[model samples]
Target: MTRKKNSGDFLKECMADALFILLRTKSIEEITVSEITALANVSRITYYRNFTSKEKVIEFKLDKLISQWIHEHPRKESASAYESSLSFFQFFYSIHDIVQTLIRANLSVMLLNRLILKFHDFNTPDRNEYYRQIFISFGLCGIILTWMDNGMKESPEQMAETVSRRFFPQPEP
Candidate 1:
């Protein structure tokens, strides 16, 4: 027999969908927990149990998307930072709607900061690896935030190439 579905995940998805639906009609500041729970058909207690705040609902979704993308499109072990970064931007661009909403809610920076923590590899003995992750997160996040803010006129490939050149330039021989 198949295992039962995890009701917790289902509730979270309901809440997330409710939140996103509200966001389309109202800014994050205008939304309240009451509205989310009411729309999601879940109690306020369930919301609090799964998410600390409304912002968390969005962060949870974004974190999952990013992790899934990274996992599915594994970077080559020998790939340079530029290649890795381009791959990331490509995937991020594919989900521009979510990122756009996060920016509109003014929670993009906070999400990125928290996600940097989530993705940190504590098992590594190398301190530089930790620092490298932080550096990459901030740098890449800065570029993407700017692009999103400035109307995102450039195509994903263009944005990736431009950012890669500025931030992850080729090393001189």
Candidate 2:
């Protein structure tokens, strides 16, 4: 009997689990498509049908998560700039594990760089939002890396509050 094709979600989940396993054991440079397919217990054909490369898998996962968060918890039309910043940080914290894993895999920095560019395009300003977004993204990534290196001592909520305070300093009432 012919085996059924895995749904898109199922393939993505397999890829994610494979990534975690690969990140735990090997450097990103050493990982191959065959390894991912083997780890995921799916055929090479299946993996090729889903993603072009391992890097694409990581990028796809991050993009999907970011898009989903933006769709699900959109900032209020009347929300202040500070509120919007806080909301984003909160959403990032909610996905801290995946973030941490990606960081550990050395993909977080690359992903953050892409996000910085995207954020820049979204907010057109004379002051160079591109530079600002790059600075903020790198800063947050650094903070998370340090926290994880130290064993994630604080809760995500606590980290989010601290980041919000630093990035979106309270404005005068």
Candidate 3:
């Protein structure tokens, strides 16, 4: 049973990888299941078994990537906006190629929506604080999307500093 599950997981990963590779040169709508299956060296039945559509495959990949990112970063509620933004930009920059492809395809909203959902903190005790987290999630998503749109010219440190200054202004002396 474990072996079967592992094989299924492997096939799903292969299909997801193939779709992203094709996405670099072709829009998501332009690439069909046949193309993905061909590139992945898998059968149509395999593709159908694993994913409902190309969009589903992309969502699966994004979810996996976000899960990995969360595990690695483990967001701290105590971290300042600058620290959080720095890590966010650094991580996204590392995967900028995949991001750029998604942007070019006009599917950037997928990233934004996924990030908003993933960044939410479920354990918040106060309803107001929960809403605050939601707002922060949207704000963070906006900042990253804008950075990607502008070709991410600034270094992560530069971007983080700019965001920190704008969002959390210091009082005058």
How does residue 88 of candidate 2 score in lDDT? 64
Error of 1 at 119 (Å): 3.8
Residue ranges of candidate 3 with Cα displaced over 4 Å:
122-127, 170-173
lDDT of 1 by residue, 51-81 (tens): 9988789877777776787688876879876
> How many steric clashes between backbone atoms does each model show?
0, 0, 0
Task: For each candidate in turn, give its C-alpha RMSD to the true structure in angstroms.
Answer: 2.9, 4.2, 2.3
lDDT of 1 at 70: 68
- Candidate 2 stretches with Cα past 4 Å from truth are 1-6, 80-86, 117-127
Q: Of the pair 2 and 3, which is ahead by TM-score?
A: 3
- Candidate 3's residue-wise lDDT over 97-165, tens digit each? 878888888888898778867877658789898888778787877788788889899999999899888
> Between 2 and 3, whose lDDT is larger?
3
Candidates by TM-score, descending order:
3, 1, 2
User: Residue 43 lDDT in model 1?
Assistant: 99
- Clashing pairs in model 2? none
Q: For each candidate, what is the lDDT? A: 0.79, 0.72, 0.87
